[model samples]
Target: MPICPSCGAAVAGAVATCANCGHPTGPAVVPPPAIGEVVVDETAAPGPSPWGSGRIHQDRQWPTPSRGWLTAGRVLLAPTALLVVLATLGSTIAGRGGSGVDDDPAVRWTVHTFQMWLQLTLTAFGTPWRNSNSSSFGSSTSGIHVLPYAVAFGWLALLWLGQRLTARARAAAGAAEPTGPAAGAQALRTGALSAVAVLLLGWLSTGSSHVDEDSLSLSMQVTTGPAMLPLGLSGFLAAAAVVLAVDGQGALRAEAARRRWLGGWLLAWQHAARVVGALLVLLTLVSVVMQVLVDQPFPQSTFRALTVNGGVYLFGVGSGARAGVGGLRGGHEGTFALYDLGAHGGQWWLTVVPVLLAALALGWSAHRGRLTQLDRARLAVLYAVLTAALVLGTSIWLSESSTIKGQVHEARIELLGWSVTSVVVAAAAWAVFGALVVPAALDAVRRTPVPVSVPLPAQAADEPDGIVGTVELVAEERPLVGQVDVLDSHAAYRRPDAS
Candidate 1:
């Protein structure tokens, strides 16, 4: 039996990972070198392998279970704690505003409001809110899917903090962080665990109320239930996306060169991140400008407004309002309309210019050899699909209903949402044209041969120089190399034909 180098625990024969500490132990057997081949000892160096060296770069192991759990707890606790404090203050202020109810009722109202907010956060992450009612007349049920961008921001921030802490802890432990496949696996695991925990917590913290009055012969029950599957899936995805965004470094491009599928997926994710990030920055700026122009008095109000609008706009969608009473629905267009650059005359350039510039830049980089043609195509397709999905996911609807004397009245509204045909189609179209078509066109232009005129050997001073002949030279028709390099220099290079 060999002793685990990371934790000094006894290990059975040929195990890759230690059970106690979850650290990776190198392979048990070293194959003999082939004839005429020399082998260098990887352990000759005292530290981990340098990055981009085509080797696994780690000196220590993954975090111990205790550390991992502690970090995960903080990831959830910190954000929830902050939200709770804010909710308490806001609820207290609202309760004291001379609204008749002021004592225990006010306190109960505050707690109920906080619970509703928590449910909303879960709903934002894909949980569906269900309302059920039973009365002497009849029973009715309704559900809504609404995403409150403010809560989403907090959720993202929480995940980001968790990922950062994980990396920092690994560094502090003298461990080289995982990259490529390992990073993806770790992210998936972390996200799945966190999501499960959150769903359980939400279930436990669910708030419900029941009323029974014999005098009026009225009994009503209301419970807000968060669907398990949607919530878990959404939470897991959010966590995974956050982890990959934080820890991804070329996503092991060098290591996974032979695996074209994996390479393309990773490459797509990187580009998607870039496009989404750019769009978010643009939307945030627009929101800020609008806020300043509107001159909102309260800073808190401005911030809240920005978060709400920014969240919807970030996904390229529209919002609307709706109302209903006992199965009949009616409402007008929402106050916050979709920012469709396509529909806005003369301002269409706003959308085209940025995307075109980004595409051209990427095309130039690809032409210079940063990315191959196939990689670019993959990126375009994946990016478009991702954008469309994002738009769809951000669609939000909130419905609340109550029965008074057997008359059920309901108010439904779109917090942040979209229409599949318009928003989804527009987003996908933009991604395809801007991210794919533009770059490919640019590549073709750069590769085209250009004619250059040159003066044929200048006439000697002694000889007659009255008429100097000019020669037409056609530049070589080869692929244009990008001036900027985004890929690792040391990785194996393949020509276009070979690729």
Candidate 2:
């Protein structure tokens, strides 16, 4: 017996086509390649031709480590160059301004722009920063702006290009394209390369640091201030992790598209992370555009705006998160902190957007993954818990702190940090809420009326009938019982209508 591929119905072994679905039998199955197998193309010409296409097709081999290294270097160089240019321009402007008054508008604006860009890059890479020279205490100097998303945009572009080059190289080698463990290895290699590039840039930007005991002050050579190497390295690695996770998602989506279904657990989870992160990035971009449309001046106003937006997205904090500058009258630069709901003037409600979006992304991905509602709930809860834990840990360890010159004494301040408790609470609340909402939403989308076939009964063939019997109504089965009450010897009945 043969089984129909489409309908799974049994058929005779000698059948040319399936009887149930009428599909042709014996369709070909693509065989998987064996380990260490080298696939050869027999159609290529033996000798080199006018075009180099033949040679490339004939000489395909596995991607060498040297090629990988070169690819990584090329991918990382563009953004590094841009950072160098920004540094140079800022330095020139600062030197020219120092030759004049402290209020030199051109120099101030240029320096502010450069510092903002640098800060955005650091934030995107996961390093928190501080403003050491602010005169106001606890006044947020900057508003929500565009720089962080800009950094993210550049980072993702480089990563995508790197992956594309690696894929091209793999194809040229004529070996099997890497997947599973091999893909992981490739992603790690790329991430390592990117980390090195970012670490070097951080070192260059923050070349020197000095502590002044006499004046009770600390100053760094960079405008945005110097970051510790280890911290910068960790931040770079975090960014790299985001990139690799995104790459994994691209692969998963591609596979899913081919198979017409969601991928396995690991891929699905990666996809979920990718969705949430991408949404955050998108939100940042939108904030940037909104600032511009509202006529927020460039550099001065935009710098603070960028910081506000970056702080919120990176830490799961609200837009009310800001740094308060205590001017000279206060004897300190400023006191900056993630304010409580009561202190933030009701802006705490703004935190709901990202948390809600994150939960929705998680739920949708879980549904697409073919998980049960229970599984979706579990996944949502797990993701939220982990995010909260991670944010809390980052807030504790990665919060930026510095000592600045004060009128009376040395002032040490901690700023640009998140509230661990708030983050945890919001994450849990959003996850629970989204878990309840998402299933119903997906159900509505999937609901459709199934069309039914109304079956018709079979009709008999027409035929002529010969006379065989008289037409009459038969007596009921219990006729004797009804007539017994009036019967005497022979039974008789009178019709009421005849009388």
Candidate 3:
């Protein structure tokens, strides 16, 4: 008999089987190796995974400098083409056919006018412009800062669409949401590219017109100066809008709550966008109604008038006019007279437009949740500040000079002039009332408790007959506990056992 090495059982036969445990009890057989050999278990090695890859990379892959430039170039082409087409159509429609000039002169005039419209459109999109006129007698220079919201609206639409498409493309390619630094870098790149492109376009759009006559000669020129801040800000905002749209509002609110200063600005921008967007919608509706009521032959002129008027009404600033006369020796200065055409004018109802819009925007924000009363108050103040700054940036100034029999006459007009502090004060008051006070008041009304009367239990029959059961007044109160509401009611009652 042989004992089993593993279980300490005795083998019963030569077949090497243990009697008690049925274990192998024979000496192990070993194979001999030739030279040097290494062994590996093929079964233990990993096979092909069913999920294809091990881990999906989540980091955003930013474009290289060269690649970024190429992408920016591609993005530039569409807007550039659109701008050119719009400028051409606007120039063709609004331009006075060069009736007094030859074919060559007419062509030159058309081209220059087209360039002027292009510059104006650029100016509407935050570029700054300088206008100068010189003649045989005198010269005048002025800067125009009026924003044509129609053009701006179109450009912003295009920018928003482009960003949306880009974000979708990245998502389709299995890319994750971009980190803060990555998003910031992308915005900076977009802003820098936009600024450079705007500068180049401004340089190309500079135009001058000359009128040479028998006795009098006049020359007028339009050019753009450095507008790095405005152009870059426009681009940065466009990029940020895309990020907000893609990431959703919850993320924005969370980010704002995390970083007080930077987050507060982002939150304020969100409110500003909502406020301005609503105002634009209201203005558009008014313009449509005006168009329907009034028969205007030139749609372009109608559009220009509506945009300018809407801007003036929303900013609550008046227009002013000034005229001066100059000779070879000296010039007589004229007093600047302001015309009340804004909210303070005959159309005082215009003040209600922004108020109503701000109220609606604040309501929407509250419905979305996550904002406290303090956050909303801060948002209102920031919105007012932003709107006032925007009004300041878009204020318009126009100056013109002409030489008549060597005695020059000059006229200047300023729209949205000399009342910035007043506008700021008004905006702040309206924003607070509409965005904070009104909403809070409404919420309080909605949460108020309603009282109900309930009869008290009958007194004992043995008690005095004159002692009657009094009615108990109860009120339903709901206190919020986390996501659930607990009902609590109170009423006074006398017990039967009490004297």
Evaluate residue 489 in candidate 2 and report its C-alpha lDDT on the 0 to 100 scale.
Answer: 15
Q: lDDT per residue, candidate 3, 1-499, as tens digits? A: 4445555444555656666766665673122223355433343335532231222333444644453344445555555566667767766665544333344534544667677667777765655556665665556656655667667667667766676676565445434444445555455555566666665666667766665664544443433342446755665565445444543433344454455654545554566677667666765666556556656411223335235345434434321221122212222223122243332236434445555665567655542332455556666877677556655554455555556566676666653343455557766776776567765665666662211211122432333322121221221233343422122110001121222
Of 2 and 3, which scores higher on lDDT?
3
Model 2's TM-score against the true structure: 0.49
Per-residue lDDT tens digits for candidate 2, residues 322-436, read 3332223222234333353334345346555665666677656644544444445555666666566444432211223333343234333322334444566766766665554
Q: Which candidate achieves the best lDDT against the true structure?
A: 1
State in Å the error of residue 84, model 1: 3.5
Q: What are the RMSD figures for all models against the true structure?
A: 18.0, 28.2, 18.9
- The per-candidate count of clashes, in order, stands at 2, 23, 0
Worst 10 residues of 2 by lDDT: 454-463
User: Which one wins by TM-score: 1 or 2?
Assistant: 1
Off by over 4 Å in 3: 1-65, 95-109, 133-140, 209-257, 260-272, 291-347, 350-354, 367-370, 390-394, 399-413, 416-418, 448-499
- What TM-score, over all chains together, does every model reach? 0.56, 0.49, 0.57
User: 1-499, model 1: which lDDT tens digit per residue?
Assistant: 5656666666677888888789887863233335566445456467654332333433454544443344445566665565455445545544665334455653645667656555555665666777677767566667777555556666688778877886665445434445465566656666767687667757754777887888988887767667777777877888778776666543454333445566556655666666656655655565566466645421123224235444334335321111111231243243223343333334323434434444454444333333445565666676667656655654556676666677877776654444555654665566566555665676577663211221122432233322111111222132324431223221111121222
